[model samples]
Structures are given as structure tokens and as C-alpha cells.
Target chain A: MIDEWYPVGLFSQLDPAGRQTALMGEPITVGRDAEGNTRVTGGNGRTLPVRLRYGHVWSSLGEPKKELFAIPEADQPGRRFVDVGVVRVRCSPLRAVENFLDVAHFPFVHTDILGAEPHTEVQNYKVEIREDVDEVWATQVKFYQPQAAKSASGGITTEYMYRVPAPTCSVLYKTCPPRPSEWDVITLFVQPLAEDLCDVWPWMALFDDTTSLTDLIHFQQTIFLQDRSILENQIPCLLPLDPGMEIPTRADLTSVAYRRWLKRHNYTYGAQLVAQ
Target chain B: MHSDTTGSWTPVALSADLPAGTVMPVQIPAGSLALWRTDSGHTAASADRCPHRGMRLSHGFVRGEALSCIYHGWSYAQAGNCLRIPAHPGLVPPETIRVVTHMVEEADGVIWVALGRPEGRPPGLEGLVPLRSLTALANIDAIAAAAGGKTSPQGIVEVASGTGTICLLLSRQDEDRTLIHVLLKGITDQAARIAAVRSTESLRRKAEDIHKKEFAQ
Candidate 1:
């Protein structure tokens, strides 16, 4: 388990006048604010004062080490740089679309599973092998209670391949957050075209209606493009995955567990960082 | 500001919006409250004021089914009784130091906080489950006016979305703002749910913008 990559830094501020800064570090751009606060410039040159929450620009992308039955699910831990103020979230081995149940790692820490009650063993599990590249699709099936979910129609799945050297450029999964149940999931994946950049190319295969793939792509990219400035300026960018070195803390349980599982299975990637 | 004006349960939050173990600031006619959940994930609404320094209780964090104040680490039970005081770890806080409590109902997957003792439980809307809630620039009147309907005696507004009926629970966010809790009529496709949410957002923008425009003029 050897990860040659390193955490660039946490994205801090994306200020107008071409000044950006990375955290635990220096300014990536010029001076942050002409006055001392972030100013976001809109089309036609209109600027709005941007006030971000503490560590928001740094800790927006969720790192998942969830408890399935109150059992730590991450055999090996994961670390991600997060930025939520802008529209797009950039993660390494990128988790394109995180669903609701990705708990642990706070922002994504402590999520509840569906079809499977808390502490109940996963039953009726179906794994469908995909043909495109090489991947497995996992569907967590369950009947909905009137109190938890209003209806059940098409089944749901959280399908993705956690191949290292950066996870599958995107995640194909259905997501809803931790609740008592009673919600539908968005099944989609992220298509990463670059290490520092990617597109939210959404999937149109799961639904019944005729939503234009072009439209979904446009919508997702439009939002993320607006978020570029803020996300790129992170500090300790993405944490380097060092398989040889073991850094264990109580908080690292979930991430460490996930990483360990990935290593056990022999996940691999190419020596190239492609530019899309 | 008691809702003797309309005896009803008000929309506090949509199911998806309020994540577990976090306290979100919510509004009622009387004032705001620290609406949060314990670590085990149970919804509780207590007076927004921390008993110690009267700081906003919503500024606190959830430990394990109890909300702890951000300032002095004063913990309170779901029923609004003082549970623990960091200053006096072993001593049980007197009952009098408790913040006022509100009756909470989780009917139809939406968490509803009763402003006062309502006559009956929250209305069981046949099929709809809570989605998410967002603050709007418009108040109840403008929302109803924009939705082409009026608020029911219970303060719920029904809207027709993409041929499906969606119910909105409207509560005052502040002086000129309203917090909307949206739920669909019944189960439809997840895409339909998204459409309903989008439609409602469009309606809210129209209504709130209109209200703002009118006020500006």
C-alpha cells in the first residue's frame, strides 16, 4: 500500500482582484481583500462580500469512516480536503457524489444506513458486476416503513470502486443522509478529468424521465466552475496516503479502516495524472 | 407573540436538512430556540437562551441526546431541564434553571414543534415525507399569495407542483422572513421530489422577490 501523492494544502480564500491563499501556508494569489474581507465578483463586475464559516474552505469535502452497525467501517482511514462555500467539492481519489448515509469524518461522519437497521446485519445484499471498466455495484435493499419512508419504487444502490492511486475518478452511488428513513437517494458519479479539476458529469441511466445529459452536465459544471477559486486554494491540499507509515489516533479509526480494506484488495492506478 | 393568533403546530425543519448531532437555529412566534439532536439522534427544541450567560443555545453542540451550551458547557435534557453543569459536574442542576420546552412531534417524517399546547397531534398527511427546509425572504402572507392559496388555520400551505400536491409548513424566520418546511403529497419518483423542491424554490424566489420589490417601491 504505497501512495506517492501528498496533501497540497487546505483551500483557504478565493478573493477577487486575483488573490487566493492556501491554508497552514501562504497566499496563492495577490492580496486577499482590498479592504480585509472576501469580495466575490459576479457577472457584469458586481461584487458581494463573502463571509465564510471557520475552517469551511478547509474542511468541506467529507472523509467517511462510518459505523454500519455501530461498527467502525473504515478498516483503513481516509483524509480529504474540503471546501463547501463554493458549489463544488474536490476530493482525492475523488468521491464525486457523496450520498446522505456517508457518516463518520463529521461532515460525513456518523451517517445511518438504510434497509439495514442500526446494528442489524446487512441482508439481501446484491452485488452486480459492471462491464465498462472493472467494478462492482452494491445495492443495500430494504422495505420502507410508513414512518421512515413515504414510498419505495425503483431500488437504490451505493455503487463505486475504491481503486487507489486516486479512487475511481467518480463515485456511482445513491445517497440520503442519516435519518429514521423516508427519503429518496440521488444515484450519480463524478467524472474527474484532471487531478486539480473535474466535471460533475451526472448519470442519466437510473431515472425514468428524459433529463438531458447535456443539461445535467451543464448544470453541474456551471455550479462547480463558480466554486473553482475557493476549492483550489486549500492548505495541506490532499493528505498523502503513506502505506509504509502508520499514524493511528482514535479519530483516525474510520479512515484507517477504509484504507486497510482498499490495500488488502490490491487497488492500483497508472503512473500518469491525465489532464482533461 | 404567542400563536393564540392561530392555534397550530408550525413547521420547524425538513427531515433531510437537520443532520444528526448538530443544533440549528429555528424560529417561533415567541422567539428562537436551539433545535438540535443528541448524539444518538433525537430531535429536541429548547429555549434558545443558555441558562448561564443567556447566550444563544443554538450556538451549542450535541453530545449524546442532550444539547450543551457553547459558553459554560451547561447541558440540558430534551424536555428543557438542566441536565449537567460543567461548573458543578456531580451536582444535579435545580429544576428552576431549565429553559422553556416545546412539545415536539415527528409525524410524516417532518419534525414539528408546537408553539403552544395544540388540541391534537400534527396532521398525518397521507403519504408525504419531509424533504428539506430553507429560509425565505417572504413572510406567510407573501408565500400564500405567491402559491395562489391561503395559509390554513394550522398555518400549512398546499401548493400544486408538477401535477402533484406538496404541503408547506410556514413559520416566521424573523420580522420579514419565513422558514418553509416542504413535504410532497405522496410517494413519487425521486426525480419528482427534486422537481417539487425546484418548483417550490422557484415559487419562493418569485414570492420573496415580489415582496421585496413591493417593499422597495
Candidate 2:
């Protein structure tokens, strides 16, 4: 967890006035200099590697072996890029990512907005590790959403594709209403503050011209805030890698695959080895 | 510190803060507590963690007389017994599936939580009435020094300001923080009440500064 770059705060959250934030349980200060360049100081009063990418301030406490993962849709023009800001979640970062990948919760946690009763069936989906690139992907995921997008007027069968490029970053591709040919890219970047606490940063690149930016932001915030209560109230705030405590059915294939990938990387930063 | 199992009543909160059909988390010398009030306006305190999966019962919602966990909808009665488990509606919950409970007493608009079996009721507030409650980032000694008074065994410290006599009821939240409930001794007007509030704020600032200095030395 230390070697990898984590999103500390949004680019807009930082200013010349300066602010203090925490990453990986270490307190850090971020500010701008006279020339308007970003300056960061770690908990030990030492310089840290700071990078501005995808509208967030990324920092690494230890030496990072690789750069931040690239989202090709972010560079495409005419796509509305939104910064949903940071939301503090009282659960493990891995649990947040895992919850984002599971569509079965739509009928329950996100009722009426994402899914409603009578259409709560989760069809078969394909989950693969993609060993060539060392990333996990869940494809052919289809779910019915009463309001799929901010611009959507009616219910539609929303097709989703989830990609887990890193331990705490998850990108979702969903069917766009305005641009039916293309898909909307929504990403969740989690900064694990502690083993059982995290700050989630959600960014989206969508193809919608009718919806206002404020409405889009509110829509995403409303959806995520509904999940926050469930996330925090979950027993054992840390995500348990073992399925012994929980009963996973066929609908939890994606969650199962994600757990396997996390286990493969030995990403126990916010993972509980056993159910406590 | 009042660490005795009995005769130790901690003023956890004000009666106005916790209304009917609501629950909140509280910390005491014994451990954490899930303080809740039923729809009938009866207050109860239970061990915070759920017996099912260790979920904080403070996060649960109150429905009528039972508190239901948000995770799996496991409801517990006011007596800390598991009333119902949503997953198995037909099966009766075992007797062991119950949380530890504590004695609660509400008087003079202040909510008192007992650590163990108390021999008698909570200490009387006499004619004093609770005004407001606030948390200070200082221990009992620092707070008493700032208020120019000594704390009694009952955790009541009387502070005299220019406006009136304000009594500070202290409850140790942790090592550094103390929960203080402000009470008025006599009938006061609006202006006097405002002054009491301001004086309490000043006392908190002074006590925090003294605490910082003590730590530094």
C-alpha cells in the first residue's frame, strides 16, 4: 500500500492557502508555492512524490514502482469530466471497491434508482484475471436501472463492464443514454486512511449533453451516499478475504474474482485475514 | 478516577439530545454503549456490538420498541435480548444471543449511565436545571483549575461567573476529553443564560491551553 500512489485530495481541494490531509494513516500537508507549483510534506517532515492526474493530487509515501493507471476515455473531447469530490467511508478500501463491482446490491441498497423489485435477477457474467496485463475484469454484466444516467428519462437495461486495474481503483463502463454507441466511464479511487477507514474519490467521464453538471454531481452523490450507511454498518469494518463468514452465491462471482485477485497481490492493507 | 463497579454514574448526555425512536453511541469507563429511547420515551443502554456479526448497534435504527441492525435487520429488544433475526423469521433466537445492558437514570434533564449495579439512584441535581452540554479537550483537573473550583466525588464542579452560578457535571470520555453538562443553580433570564454559555466557552479555552502546557512540560 505504501509503494503505490494514492489519491490524496482533489485538485480543486488544494489551494495556495494550504490544507492538511492524511494518506495511508500518515498526516501530510499539501499547498502551492509562489510559482503555483504543488508542494507536499509527509508525516516525517520530508518531501513526497506528488503528481496531478485525473483531477486529483496523487502522493506516495514510499517509492512508487509504476505510474498511475491510464483511463483513455478521460482524454477524449466532448465527454463531460466530473470530479465528485471526496467521501469518507468507514469501511475498508477494498470493501468499497468490491461493493462497486457487485451489481446484486442494486435491488436492495440502491433500490428504485439503480434497480427495483421484479427485475432483481443477476444474469451470468464472465470474470477473468487477464494474466497478460495482471488486471481483473468483469464483462457482460447487465442490470436494469430505473434511471441509468442523469439524462435518462426511463428505465433501461444497463450494461456494465468493471475493471480493477489496482487494489483500490475500480473503473466501470456503462451504457450511455445520449451516446448509445459509446459507454460512460465512471471510476472510484479509494485512499485507505486506515485498515478500516478510507476516503473515496469518484470521477466520471460521461457522454451526456442534456444534464447540467450540478445535476450530474448530485445524482452520483445521492447514489453513493445511499451505499455509505451500509458500508459503515457492515460488521467487521475491514474486508474479510475469507468467504467463510459470508455466504456467496452464484451472483457473487465478481466479488469472488476480486477477492482472488487481491489475495494474489498480497494486498492485505485493508483486508482481514480472518473473520473477526 | 471513578472506576468502581458500583456507585459510578456517568452523565453521558443531555435528555434533549436523545429523543424518542433514536439511538446513539456512547463511551464509558466500562466500554461502549448503544443508548436508545423507545417510542414510548423510555431510555435504555446496551453493549454497542451486535452478537450476530459485531456490527455497532449504535448504527442501527429504532422501530417502535426494538432496534434493528442495518446490516441484516437483526432486531434487539430494550432488555438487550435478540428479538428477531430477519434471515430466519421462524426460528427462535437463542437466549445467549443477547447484549449486556447498563442501568440508565434520567433526572434534571441529564441522562446518567451507570457502569454496574448501583445501590441507589443517581446523585440529585437539587434545584439545578441543565442548560447545555459541551465537550472539552481537557481532563477534569485542568477543567477544574480553569473554572477556579475543585471537583467533588460526584463529578460536580461549581464555577462562579459574573452572571450566575454555573455547575459543571463532568464525565471522563477518555484520557484527554471530558464531557461537561452545564447546569444553572437559580432562575436566570435570557441575558444571564447567554452569559453562562459564553463563560463556559472561555473556561474550555483556558482549560485546553493549560492542558497543552502541562503536556509540553
Candidate 3:
């Protein structure tokens, strides 16, 4: 988990003095060098690799074998890149990613904004662990969402595809209300400050031209903040990898696959291995 | 601090503070627990975690005689047994899917939670009436010093006010925090009650100051 690149701060929102943050429980400072290039320094005064992608400053505590995962929509023209900022949640980073992958919570947590009563049934979805990229992906997921996006005028049955490129990162591709041909991309890049704490950086690449930038950020922030209360209040704080610890229904296929993938890779930083 | 297996009863809250059909989070030496009252006024304490998911049951709502989780709507009875699963309506949850429940008793306007099987009921404050409950960011020692009295074995600290003696039931929430339940000894009027409340507030402030100073030293 320490070897994976984690987002520290938004490139546009970094403080001049230095932005103080943590990665995998190690205190780090995110600042720019004299050349205006992003620099990350660990608590031990060791310089770490820094990558500026997805409008955020990414860093790693250890040597990473692979480069930061790519999001093709971020590079697409005419797509508005929305930086939704960071929300510090007192929960396991794995749990945050799992919650982001879950569609069943939309009706209960996000309420009318994402889903409403009687439309709570989560239809069967396909989940797979792609060996080619060593990533967990869920496709053909459908849910009834009210005001699917900031530009949505009414309710729509949203089509969603979720991808977990990294243990703590998840990118979501959902149906774009205005441009049905193209998908709206929303990504949750979680910085695991500790085993049970994280700083969630939610970024979006959308084809919406109607909503203002502030309105777009607010809309995303409102949705994420509604999830914060649920995330923080979850008991045990750590994500339980043991199947017996948490009972999952058919709607939790993505979560189950994610946990199994994490277990397969032996990534148990913020995960409870056995039932307590 | 009390052990979970001991026959010790910890004062969690005042009876008047926890109304029927409401749930609240309470902390004991062992850990945090969800204390909820059924619509029929039956109080129960269970491990805050839901068996299905780790969602805190305290965030759930009380419908009829069951406590329902806000996340997935899995309901639990007062005995901590899984009553229903909203997602799987027809299926009856297995008995193994149950939250750990603790023994609770309400007596003398105070709600007491037993860490284990208690040999006796909670101590009775015969003539005193509960005024209110407050949390002080100070240990029991600091509170005792501020009140100019020490706590009895029953966890009662008697401090004389203008009207009569006010008894404070102190429960150590953690190393630096204490829960104080104020009780009035005599038949006090509204003004005296207000004065007692003010005095308790002042005592808490003093205790917190002392605690801060002690930590600095």
C-alpha cells in the first residue's frame, strides 16, 4: 500500500508556504521547487516521487513499480475538469473506496439527489478482476438516479462502470445526461493518512456546459459530504476483509470483488483480516 | 475504570435525558455502545456496531420495538437479535447475526449499564431528583477538587449550594473526561434549580482549568 501513489493535494490549491499532509501515516509536505515543479518531502526528510496528474499532487512513500494510473477522459477535449477538493473522513481508505463503488447506498445516503424510495433495488451487475491491468472493474451497473448530474433536468436511469486502478483509488464512469454518447467521469482519490483515516480528493471530468464551476464543485461536495457522516460513524473504523464480519447481498458484488482483490494482493493496511 | 467482566454498573445517562423511541451513543470503559429506548419505553444497550455492516446502530432509528440501521435498514430487537433485513424481506436472519447486548437498569432517575452480570441493582438516591447531565473535560480528581468534595463509593459528590446540597453522580468517561449527573436534594423552585445548574457549570469550568494546568505542569 505504501508503494502505491496517493494524492496529497490539488495542484491549483497548494499553499505557497507548503501544504502539510500525510501518506500512509507518514507526515509529508507538498510544495513546489524553485523550478515551479511539484516536490514532496517525507517526515524523515527524504524526497519522494511526485506526479502531477488528474489536477492533483501525487506522491509515494516507497518505490512504485508502475506509474500512476491513467484516466483517458481527463485528456479529452471539451470536457470540464472539476476539482471538488478534499474531504477528511474518519474511516478506512478501503472503506471509502468500497462505499464509492456501492450503488445501494445512493437511495439511503444521498436521498433524492442520487436516488429515492421504492427505486432502491440494485439490478444485477458484472464484476471482474482484470488480470491485464491488475485492476478491479464493475461494468453494466444500472441505477435509477434523480438529478443524475448537475445539468440533469429530471430523473434518469444512470448507467455506471466502476474501476479500481489502485487500492485506494476508484474512477467511476456514469451516463452523461446531456451527452449520452460519452460518459461522465468522477474519480475518488483517497489519501490514507492512517489505517482508519483518509483525505478524499473527488475530481470529475464532465461534458456539462450548463452548470457553473462553483455549482459543479458544490454539487459534488454536497454528495460526498452526505457520505461523510455515514463513513465516520461506521464502527470498527477499519475495513473488514473477513466475509463473516460483514454480510453482503447480491448488490455488493463490486465490494466483494474489491475485498477479494485486496486480499489476493495482501494489501491489508486499513483492513481487518479476521472477524473480531 | 471498570473491567467488562466485572459486576460493575456504570452510570451512562439520566433517565429523563433518554426519551422513548430515541437512540444515543454512550461510552464505557470497554468501548462505545448504542443506548436506545423502544417506543414502549424499554431501554436497551447494545454494541454500537451492526452485525451486517459495521455501521453504528446509534445512527439508526427506532421503529416500533426494533432499532433499524440507517445504512441498509437491518433492524435489531431490544435483546440484540436481528429482527429483519430490509433488503431481504422474506428471509429471517440467522441467530448468529446479533449484536452484543449489555444489562441496563433505570433507578432513581439514573440509567445504569452493567459491564457484566451485576449482583445487585443500581444504587438508589432516595429523595433526590435529577436536574440535568453534563460532560466535563476533566478527570474525576479535578472535578472533586473543584467541587470541594470527594466522591463516595456510590460515585456521589455532595456539594452545598444556596438552596440545599447538590449531589453529582460522576462517571469516568475516559482519562480526561467525566460525565456528571446533577441531582437536587430538597424541593427546589425554578430559581434554585437554575442556580444549581449555574453552579454545576461553574464547577465544570474550574475543573477544566485545573485539568489544563495540571497537564501543562
Candidate 4:
């Protein structure tokens, strides 16, 4: 059940300091030894596999069947890779990733900053499960962004494309204000601390070089913090695949497809199969 | 008129702790409750879970006199009646859309919630005032052992401390923890208040240590 690699903490956060954290509700410590290698110890000094990627330290309770998902844009030169840090959300890990995939809450939760009233319309988007890579993708998602990016001065219609390579991870490619041709990549890596709780680590690789590091971190943190209250207060806490507990509109197609993919993979770690 | 099912009273929290237009989670003998106070200084206690999708009403917010769920902004009155459904503003919610509520009584800086009919009112701290409430990672027995006194039938355990007498009103929380509300018998000065706080903190530490040692065996 713990065969998949889940991120425990940021590599930077662990390299400089030892952290007491949990992975799938198992208390574990994340730190580096004297030889400069990642060390993870669970209850009663049980060690697990440790790896560093995408500015995060990942560990698996059991042998992972696959390596960490790839983010090619992270290594691309001239792109500012900003680590937005972690936020503990009292909701399922899959729910955190699905919320990142959702653009419908922009006007309601992120009002005025990302979207505003009267502009709260979600047009049709294409969603599918890619057979070759066994991933979920949603494309051609166009939304009116009051501030498209940190570098944007005015409103613009932003285009978004979402990719879900892992059950708890999702990547978003959105329209960049500075470079019209290139798309900014924002990725959410959720660590399921328990079936009803998770820690979300959001990383961004964008084309803009103007915004300072603190501003970039703060801008993303504000948006995520605004969402944290809503996530924790949701019913059942775990992500419900059956949609019986909730009413889905036309805009929830991506979420529906993602749930289907998760069910197909039998990723029931943080998923509620029934309505309750 | 309240029935026999709404009579047994248990001290849930302090009146000062729950401010106006705020909701807090509380646990009693019956179960968990959403203890809240309206803007007009009226208090209420409702079943912790919401009726819609079972969201914890304690995690919800209060606007004016109504408690609104944080998930979808479903508002409910202090009398356990549904007032507003933000998603469907035009439609009037049916009478069955109501939450189970308990009878609440606030007296002498303490708030008591009732699940069923009781013979008498909650114990009145006539001269004592509530200083603070702290959770101890120990059971009631461990806390009583640490205080060198037995808990009375009224849930009051008096400990003779160097800073005079400190009375702790214990409430069971979860499995191995106790919510202790510290009440000062006579001391109410600034220095005495600080001393009472220190005494309770020391008691909690000792109780937790005792509990850990006992469980480790």
C-alpha cells in the first residue's frame, strides 16, 4: 500500500534542518546524515527509501513500483523555479490535487485576485486519459484572469492545460504574461499524511524574471491559504469518487475524469469509495 | 418545554472563551457539539456534524445571528432551524432540514450543555472564577493521582497547592486526555492568577508523565 513515493518535506528544508513529519500517517524523520545523503526513519528506527527531486525529499514505506514523475521544465535554463513551500490541509491528498486542477473556484474563493464576479463562467474543456503514458490531461481551458500572473498589469484571457501523472500530483501549464509563446508551469505535490489530511507542496517554473522570490512565494501562498479553510471544512474530508455526496456541473468534467482514473488504478489511500 | 432527552448538563466551556458570533467545538457525555454564541449574546449547542454532507459545524463560521457552514454557506439559527441555503437562495429549506440542538446555560463564567433532563443545575462556583482551560495528555485517574486527590461526583478535584487551593473541573476528551478548567477558589489578583496558571501547568506535566510511565509498563 505504501509502494508509491510520497514527498515528506522540501529538500532545502531537510538539508539545513531535521524535520519530524508523517507519511501516510506514519511518523517519520527527514534529515541528511554526515555523508550528505537523505535519511528517513519511521517508528522504532525503521528506514525507508529516500530520494531528492523537484526541491522535495520523497520516501516510500514500501518499494516504489516507479520513480518520481518527471517535470522537464524544471531543468530548462532561464526559468525561475520557485519552491512555494508546504501547507497542511485537512483534506484528502487527491482532493488537494483535484482542487489545484479546478479553475471553477477562482471567482468564489480567490475573488478579485484571480477572478471576480460577473466573469465567473467556465467554458467547455477537453479532458481525457492518455493511454500511452497512463496519465490524465485536461486541455484548452480558457478563463478570464484579472491578474494572469504576478507580472501581469491588467486583465487577460488565460489558457490553461492540466496534467496528472501521479495520483497525488498535478501540473498546470498556464498562459504567461511575459512570454506569450511559453506557458508557466505550476505543479502541486501532495503528501497524504492520512486518509483525511495532507501536506501540499506547490512549485512553479515560470518565464518571468521580474518578480522577487518573496513576492512570488507570498502570491502563491495567499492563494493557497485562501483555499485551505475551504478544504478543511469540506464534508467527509476524504475525496469521494462516487459523486453521490456532491452535485457535479458541466465544469466538473476534469474532476470526474481524474476520479475515474484514480479508481481504475485502485488508488484508494485517500479516496472514499462510497458517498459517506 | 425541554424533554427528558435534553436534561443532563455538563460544563462544556467558559463564557468568555466563546465570543459573540463565534463557533467552537465542544465534547460532552452525549457526543461532540458545536458551541456557538450569536451577535446578540445568545448561546447555542448543535450536533457537531452538519445535516447536508456531514461537515463539522464547529468548523463553520457565524455571521450575525446565524451559523454558516464553511463548505457551502448553509446557515442555521440558534434554535436548530435552517435559515438560509446560499446555493439555493430562492428556495425555502424544509422543516426537516434542522440540526439537533442541546439546552445551554451560562452561569458564573461557565457554560453548561445538556443532552438529557437532569435533577438539578450545574455546580455553581460561587466564589471561584475561571482562570483558564488546558488539556492534559492523561486520563482522569492520572490527573487525580497527580493532584493527590480524588475527583468528586461533581467532577471537581481540589488540589492544595503552595499558591493556595486550585480546583480543576475535569471533562473527558477523546481516549487518554482530559480537559481541565482551572478555577481559583479565592485568589483573583494578577500574581495569584499567574501562580494558578503555573500550578496547573505543573500538574498537567506530572499527570502526563505518570500516564506515560503507566502505559509503558
- Return the top candidate by lDDT: 3
Residue range A90-161, candidate 4, lDDT tens digits: 898987887888776676577777876557667888999999888899999988878867899888889999
Give the per-residue lDDT of model 1 (tens digit) for A83-163: 222233453233222221121111111112122222222223343434443333344533222122112233333222222
True contacts kept of 3: 0.56
Of candidates 4 and 3, the better by DockQ: 3
List, residue by residue over A1-276, the lDDT tens digit for candidate 2.
Answer: 678888888888788887787877889888887899888889989999999988888888899887877889989998988999889998989888988987866765677788875576677889999998778999999988998878888999999999998899999999988888999999999988888899999999999888889999999998889888878876677777876655454567788888888888898898888864
Of 1 and 2, the candidate ahead on DockQ is 2
| Model 3, residue pairs in steric clash | none
Each candidate structure's TM-score, on Cα atoms with residue i matched to residue i, is 0.42, 0.67, 0.91, 0.69
List of chain B TM-scores, one per candidate? 0.84, 0.92, 0.95, 0.91
| Residue range B1-217, candidate 1, lDDT tens digits | 1254446677777656668888988788777777887777788889887644345678778987888765345678898888866433446677776777888777667777887677677766657767678788886778888889988876778987666788887778676888887877763789989888788889888889867866433
- Residue pairs in clash, model 2: none
* Number of the top DockQ candidate: 3
**Model 1: CAPRI class:** incorrect
All candidates: DockQ:
0.01, 0.11, 0.50, 0.13
> Model 1 segments beyond 4 Å from truth?
A1-276, B1-7, B215-217
For candidate 1 chain A, the 10 contiguous residues with the lowest summed lDDT are: A67-76
* Clash count (model 3, backbone only): 0
lDDT of 3 by residue, B1-217 (tens): 2233458888999989889999998989888899999999999999999876689988988988899888877789999899876554567888888999999989888899998786777787899999999999999989998999988878889998775899989999988999999999984899889889889989999999998888434
> lDDT at A33 for candidate 2?
75
Record all residue pairs in model 4 with backbone atoms less than 3 Å apart, i.e. clashing: B5-B116, B6-B116, B7-B116, B7-B117, B7-B118, B8-B116
Cα lDDT tens digits, model 2, B1-217, are: 2345566678898899999999998889766789999999999998887765456788888989998765445678988888876534455777767777888999889888887676677877878878898988898889998989999878889987554679999998877888899999873888888888898999999999988788434
Relative to the true structure, how large is the alpha-carbon lDDT of every model? 0.48, 0.83, 0.89, 0.83
How do the candidates rank by TM-score, highest first? 3, 4, 2, 1
